[model samples]
Target chain A: MNPQPSLNALQSILETLLPQMEQGKFSKVECHFVRALLEQFKNHSRVFAELELSTRHLKEALGETENAANTLLTLAEDLQRDERTEDIGLQISEACAFQDIVGQRLKLVQKTLYSYVDFLALMGTTTQTSPATIMSGPGFTGEVISQDDADRLMG
Target chain B: MAVSKDMPILIVDDFKTMLRITRQMLAQLGFMNVTEATDGVDAIEKMGQKDFALIISDWNMEPMSGYDLLKHVRGASKTPTVPFVMVTAERKPENVIAAKKAGVSNYIIKPFNAGTLKSKLMAVLGPF
Candidate 1:
């Protein structure tokens, strides 16, 4: 029987090369994914930007209503201390919080877009030679980690 | 330590929105004096210029990450012991371990609200 390319360094080589191959495969897939994401990103960015603008306009419009309501409540004893009257202020503040949450989510996708490009750029630079195993974790997904888990890891 | 409201907190993050939200949260908690740094390198440069009561930094930055900044800050005798809070969207145990080992005073995850920011600050800096 032939020397069987020797199981010698084969496992280590496989271990090393398999990961690279996997990453390369991912990089290939991500190239297309990035293009799609970029196109989506353009539309997404425009939509979110418009959404943010529209929300701000709505909030400003509500502010006028709120001012009117406040003035009415103060002058007209009928509207004063009413639950529905008070609810307007509360509702506007809550709605303002909604726009911010949308902004946060929009930022997450933007970061994801950056990561896709960065990853592709990195793989592009290292394709000829062995790619450095970037241990940097996946790109930001806007997920929150628990403090307990954080502490446990610290320990 | 019952820090004061005008404790001169430093907020570091690349995103304008994060910085704005953080500043708002700090303001809500009565931390009126706030400073902003766009990234870890910018943060290090600013910290080198003046001492801040606390440093709140986002973790994934280009070239100089929050982890890299933490290491540099810890290495520098000037602000080595300053309270550094690592803000990140990462959920990796090893990343947390890396920050903690790098001498982070506390950690705040992403999409955080004023309440979470308040609790983290209180935990690290004591009550206002």
Candidate 2:
């Protein structure tokens, strides 16, 4: 019917279904059924674009953290030479702020990476599942297990 | 300010950036004689070649860590009693207690500023 809809249309349907999937009200059978629908819609160009963006964010966040560390080192040297203890303290505070920002960015990147992995698994293109997916597996397998079991089995 | 220019200081850290930072700080404090080591094994080897007045080491490192280095140094007859400082990311009370029990002369937690380093050095060495 309607040429089985394009990949983009299927992906949109899956995207719309995500909120329901996350609501936690769905039974195992219902979840599996929705996941099967997601599998049918996994190969959209938009998903690949999102994955690329997520990877870039991860790299950027890591680079920022490294750069902040290096800057702190240089500031320490300057402060020591001038015997400016107060300034050194201020710089350290600034460095810590950068560290906090980097941590937030890393979290965002991690979430995006998780989403990308889930998208990949839904497409049946990836045999691997994200460590984030504890109760889920390929083919919409509705397996309820402990956190430890999910960690060992998924990653 | 208390350290002598001739007194050799050993800086140990896995990250080159940290080593450079420590060296610069020491230099500013007027300690001209400084040596570098990547980890505990390298620090021990270097210490064997020449005695160091002070050893500043990072706690976490690959192969051999700072704790191991401190133990090795204290265990050595020639190096025993040498001033040792642990610079580390771990600032927990238990970690500090362990390092103190291991005979660390001073403990400087990571993200330390120049003032903290200077104060620690002065506390350990006294005013020059």
* Highest-lDDT candidate: 2
Docking quality category of candidate 1 according to DockQ thresholds: incorrect
Query: Candidate 2 lDDT, tens digit per residue, A70-140?
Result: 98888888886887675576556546544433443455556666776676665555433443321101111
Q: At residue B77, what lDDT does model 1 achieve?
A: 82
Chain A TM per prediction:
0.30, 0.47
Give me the displacement of residue B103 in model 1, in angstroms. Answer: 0.6
Of the candidates shown, which would achieve the greatest TM-score relative to the real structure? Answer: 1
Reference contacts recovered by each candidate, as fractions? Answer: 0.25, 0.00
Query: Global lDDT for candidate 1?
Result: 0.64
Q: What share of the true interface contacts does candidate 2 keep?
A: 0.00
Question: Lowest-lDDT window of 10 residues in candidate 2 chain A?
Answer: A133-142
lDDT of each: 0.64, 0.68
Interface RMSD of 2: 15.2
Q: What tens-digit string does per-residue lDDT give for candidate 2 at B1-128?
A: 54576898999987676677777677666787999999999998898799899999988765797988898888989988989988765445555667777888888755566667787788678875
Where in model 2 is the C-alpha error above 4 Å? A1-155, B1-3
Query: Relative to the unseen true structure, what is the C-alpha lDDT of residue B62 in candidate 2, on a scale of 0 to 100?
Result: 54
Report how closely model 2 matches the true complex, as a DockQ value.
Answer: 0.05
